[model samples]
Each structure stands twice: as structure tokens, then as C-alpha cells.
Target: MHKKDNNIDIANDRNENIPTERISTMFSFGMGDFIYEVFNGIFGAFFFLYWETEVKLDIWIVTLAYVIFAIWNSANDPLIGYLTDRPNRFWKKYGKRFPMVMIGTVPAILTLAAIFSPPFLDPVQGAWIYFAWILITTCSYELFFTLSSLNHYALYPEKFKTDRQRRRAGGIRMALALVGTAIGFIVPPLLIEYENRASYTNMVWIFVIFNLIFFLSLIPGHRESNYLKKRYMKEKEEQKEQISFWDSIRIVLRHKNFLVVILIFFLDSIIGVSLTASVQYVAKYVLEAEAETSIYILAGFILGALISLGPWLFFSEKINDNRRMLIIGVFLNTIFLLPFMFANDLFWLVIAAVLLGIGGGALRIGRNPVMADAIDEATLNSKRHLEGAFMGVYTFFNRFALIAQGIIFAVVHELTGFNANLPNQTELAKFGIRLHTALIPMILTLIGLIIFFRVYDLFPEKTAKIKQKLKELKL
Candidate 1:
């Protein structure tokens, strides 16, 4: 029998050595983001466009469906988090997160296909059907996504305990995430033509297959090491007193560092969703460009992000502070976004995409490491190791950004007198599209940067102290 160690391992206590196999495993795990990004890109960039343009649903109905879905999405996250974090016999056999992840894979794939495959009906009847399907599919998708992603993310701090390790792993992860974004945003434009249902359905199927492939690739990587398994088991044994679900909510809400992280992510989500949702509009209406033109713009963004990842990684390592790096990245991204409001041709748009991509690389790479630091601090402070709870609450607020995106688009289009029935929009409507694509995202990011600098207190020294405390607590 193995004896449980009360003292948790710290980076300083061990040699700075990672097994070669573990590195490979971690990189393979990064591919899982491909599935998530593809799905996210499709839903964020095209789902509303499809419903509003192809199916010709009223904007308010679409917004109302999303608002309801957002509520449901938020409520389910904490419940899943609370349940997953609790000690259970199943985790002893299959690991804590892998089972939930696997359980969600098939349903996530099926529902993704359903979202794009609503049956033929009149516009009014189809609107109700579309509304119902959106609610069902989005709620279902988020449920399993939360289950898998929360657990997958929870493992990061435990597995990569040192800053050096996190930077290496996180850099690769963000790179893969961008690749997924490319596949999600770039390829579909090539497959699906403007308002072509058959092509759209085909594209959906292709994404479904890709989702299955990448998510399945994560299984081997999702396995917990013997050391982690033992640590979790020990923590479970020692902490027999379970906190109530409401109490878990209260604790996470009260955490200043966690709140800062959520706020930044929340604002970022709004900006990201707005930009994505407006891409097709920008390509079609603003540039008066072909449907395929959006692919080039999105490709430019992805390529820039991929190319700049190395430099951002190095800069973050040099500064040794994720918060400052994020602030710098978001500020630069905001500057890049401004040019888009004035862009009328493909050349300038692609140029702006590249610059935005560079900023995005820094933002994406720094986000997780900082979030991991926050989770570590929360775990130590709470003394409960509730990664799921914290992630759940974080995800809950993040979904609100989706709700905001829907509302923003609906209101903007309505106010600007955008009619999907028209072959061409009025000048005001075109300006509204530009505003949604660039101006609004820039404004939101600026606000996020301000809050991060002023309110988020997880500086390098403070983070170091928190990690040191974790070591002292042996947690």
C-alpha cells in the first residue's frame, strides 16, 4: 500500500525535469482545443447569420432564444462543477474528468449537426422550430462542453506546477487553438456559399466529423498520472466535509482575483463574439466582396496569430508577468481594430487582420496561465481544491457575453434599418456592420484592459507568494 504524503509537491522542491512522453502527451492534449474552436467559430461566426439570412427569422426571436439559452447555460455550469468536484468512486477507476468528457462527446457531435439541420417549413413556422432547436442544441452542447472543458482545464495547474512548464505548454495550446480557429472560420467559408443550405449542411457534417476526431484524440491525454490520482485521492480523504453548492458559489464570487479574471474574459468574449458574428457581414456588405473573401481575412488573422505566438511567448517569459503582457496585448489589439472601421478593400482588411492576430496571440497565450494562477490561489484560499467550482462560475459569466452579443447585433441591425430581405443594405446599415465588427470590439477590449490594470491584483510577486503558500499548505 502507498502512504499518503501530507505535503504537496512544489516546483522548487523537485528537479526541473519533465518526461519526454509527458510532453508529447500534453501537446496531443492541445489538439482538443481544435474541436472546441471549430465549434465555437462556427456558432459564433455563422449560426446567427444563417438563421437571420438563410432561414429569415426575425432578429428579436433569435435574440430571445439565445437569452434563454444563456440563462440555462449559466445555471448548469455551477451545478456540474459542484457535482464533478465532489469525491466519488467513479473517479478512482476512470479518473475524475475523462468519464464526463467521454460521456459528452457523442451528444455534443449530434447536437452540433442538429443546429444546422432544421427541417423545411414556412418562415414563421421555421422560426419557431429554429428557436426550439437552438435552445435544445445550445443547452445540450454547453452542458457537455462544460463537463469536459472544466475538467480538462482543472488538470492544468496540477500537471504543470511551474511557470516555465505552464508557458511551454500554454504556448503550444494557444497555437493549436488558433489552428482550430482557422479550420473553424476559414474552411467553412470555402465549403458553404452565401445562403446555400445544402452546402451549409455539408459543412456542418464536416465539422461534426472533425469534432469527433479531435475530441477522441484527447482521451489518451486526459488520463491522470499516478501521482495526481494519489493526490486527489488524499485530498478527497482528508476533506470529508462537503461545502454546500450555494456556499461554493458564495466563496468563488467573493474571490477578488477570480472576479478580475472573469471580468476580463467576459469582456473579451463579447468582443470576440461580435467580431466573429460580423465577419460575413463585413465581407459581403462592407467590402462588397465575394463570399470566399471572408476566408482570406480570417486566414490572415490566424496566420498572424500563429506566426506571432513565438514572439509573444518569449516576451511573456521575459516580463514574467501575464497580467502586464495581457494588458499590452489587448491595447495593441484595440489599436489594430480601429483601422477596420475605415477598411473598404480586401488589402487593408487583411492587413488589419494580421495586426489583430498578433495582439490575439499574446492575449490567448497569456490568458490561461493567468487563469491557472488565479485557480491555484482560489484553491489555496478555499482549502477545498474546487477547480470545478471556480471554472463553473467563470464559465457561467462567460456565457453572458454570448447573450450580450446577440442583443448587440439585434439592436444594431434594428436601429440601422437592416432588412435581410434587401439585396443591399442602406449606408447606415453598412456603417452598423462596420461598427459591430471593429468599433464595438475595440471599445469592449479597452474597458477590459482598464479593469485588468486597475482591479486585478495578481502581479508576479503576489502570484509567487500565492504559489509559495500552496507549497506550505502542501495542497
Candidate 2:
């Protein structure tokens, strides 16, 4: 027997209740965030600087290389998602997402190491070589990164079915992410000096080791049950809907609510990268401080984010409105950015970091749940569990942040006449760093918040109905 509504199919052959996952399972899943943030935070914070300043590549060459990397990185994600979402031998044996995640893990870390291990060559003479190395290594890193992260993200909606569960898991993930980000930000400066290229390589090795050790936690989280596997296979057999790659992409693009989430996320990615990437410049030129000062500044931000997590989660749970929570987050973030832009001294800068952290914590708290809400609605509409494709497309847009940041930095530096070789940059250069870090991000975030407020109509009531529909459809 089957039920049909609005030309949609609902299976009656099998119905499985959503499992109540153990705290340990949640922790293991959350560990993936830690690993992801640790790598991402470091990369965002230092990768461009390493090439532009330390390697002495021409800014234009570095920018061009990143543009190429961005193109490959952003374009591959949706394809990866579509490819992996299909039924396969691995899906039947080891589980649907686990093998794919494992395949991507080691290679991703290796390539991340290779990014800092560029061949010793003259920056101007071997500019193309340097550009090629960056383009290849970074794109390679993102290839495996997309593979692992897309599956990890896909699992969230599948594994945690309830709003309460999503909130709990999301909170844990954000908390761990901040800790990983702290490690990424704090440890690099402790190990690296501006003049020493070898120190950067050493820092990469340390992160590589740390990430491998922590990746074990992901194993337990990725475990799939016989029931889940059977259900997945059964659905694949029953639906028999042949969704092509372009069709999948088309469906994802046409989802209005999903597009809103994707756009907001895209803007947020730029904000995050711009702020993180500028910290070293801020510490170096703006504050006229040693490399270690970067640690203190990052610490202030991390500590602020850490301390505010509890309150943000608490209030978000009370509100039970992911949309409202995200709105509040954006508003808070916009307000907090001004202090950092104006602060000249270490004390004031750290104070600003704290305020930014509070706002950041709020944003993190709401981001995933709202995203999950969007995913739930999409699944309900598509009548298929296409979380992988959805997440892939989301990441597809998200990776363009790299390209956007590349353009922003190139334009700003060129216009400001910022010279990386100088020990002390001009006042214009310092202002350029400030513009990317605070002012521009603030403006983009404000625009995103406004658009999100206007277009995102998946309010609590609507989301609840979507969930109910999904339940009825057994997706």
C-alpha cells in the first residue's frame, strides 16, 4: 500500500523511527567540526599571507592562482555530491557516506601539508611555478575537503530528526568548532615567525598530526546501522527516480528557501575569510606588533566566542525560532564590527575581539539549525533524501568566498599601495586591512541579514509543517 498527495509518493513498505543518538555519538559527530575548523581556520588565517608575503610571490600572481583554485574548488562540489548520492557497493557494505569520508580524509591532510611545502624558488623568476603549486595543492585540498565535508554535512539532517536534537548537536558542533579555531589561530603564531618560512612548514606538520588523532572520533559518528542501510537501499529501489547531475543542480538552485540560505551563507563565508585572513596584517602592520601579538588578538576572539556559546544556545532553545535567532545574530554581528574597526591599541582591539566573538557565537548557534531547516524543507519538496547534493551545492557557493576574498584583497591592496616587503606599511595600507576586516564584512553582512529577513519565509510554523510532511513521506 502507498499514500499519494500532490503527485508525491509516500512509501508504506517500511517505517523506522528516528533514533535517539547517544551523547558519545553526538560528540564523535561534532569532532568532525573540530577537525574541519582547525584546518579551515589556519588556512583562512595564513594561506594567502604565506604566498604573498613569505614566499614573495607577486600579489597578482597569488591572486590569480587563488582564482583558479576557487574555480576548480567551487565547481567540483555539486558533482561530487551528485556522484556520491547514488547507490553503490560501498553504500551497501561499509555504509553510504563513511567510505567516501575516509577516502577523502588522509589525502586532504597530505595536500594541506603540501600547500606549505612549496619548492624553494625565486618568487619573481619562478612565478608561474609558484602559482601552479598553489593552484594544484589548494584545489587538491578542497577536492578531498568537499568530499569529506559534504558527506558529514549530509549526515546531520539524516541522523538527527528533531529540532531539539538538531539544536543539541548544532551547539556541540559550534563549541568544538570554536575550540578548533582557537587551536588554528593560537598555535600558529606560537610556532611561526614572520621571517622564517621553515616555521610555517613545522606548524603544518603539527596540525596534520593533531587532525589525524582527532579524526578517530569521526569513525564512531559515521557508523551506519543495518536498519539505516536497508532503509536507504529500499528507498533507492522504490523511488527509482533518475535524477541527473544537471537536474539535481537545477532542483537545488530553484529552491527559494535553500537559495536564500545559500546566499546568506555565501556572504557569511566572505565575512569570515576576510576577517580571519586580515588578523596577521592587523597584528603586523596596524598594531606594529610581533607575530606573538596575533595569538593574543585571536585569543581574545576565541575566548569571547567560547564564553558566549552557552547563552546563545540557551536563548535560541527558548526562542525555538531558527529564523529569529539568525536575525538576532546578524544584527548583533553588524553592531559589534564597528568597535574593532576603530580600536587602535591592544587593549581596545582585544575588547573588540571579545565583542565580535559574542556576535560570532550567536551566529554559529543559529546557522546550522536554520540550514538544517532549509534542508528539511527541500527534502520534503523533492521527495528524496538528497542531502548530499544539497550540501554539495551549498558548499559550491560557499567556496566562492575564496575567490571573492582574493578579488577583495587584490583590489584593496592595489588601491592602497600596500607593500608586503616593507616592515612598516603606509597609513593607507593599515586602513586597507581595516576596511577588509571590519567595514566591508559589516556591510556585506548587513545586506545579507536584510535580504534574509525579507525572503526567508520558513518560519517556525512552516518548518514544523515541513517536518511533519517529511515524516509522512518517510524521507
lDDT accuracy of residue 297 in candidate 1: 93
TM-score of 2: 0.95
Tens digit of per-residue lDDT, candidate 1, span 315-424: 99999998888788778767788989887789988998999999888888788888998888888888878888888899889889988888889989999999887868
Query: Relative to the unseen true structure, what is the C-alpha lDDT of residue 414 in candidate 1, on a scale of 0 to 100?
Result: 93
- lDDT value for model 1: 0.81
Q: What is the TM-score of each candidate against the true structure?
A: 0.94, 0.95
Give the CA lDDT, 0 to 100, for residue 361 in model 1.
89
Q: Candidate 1 versus the native: TM-score? A: 0.94
lDDT of 2 by residue, 319-384 (tens): 999999988887786778888778998999999999888988998999999999998888888777
Q: lDDT per model, in order?
A: 0.81, 0.86
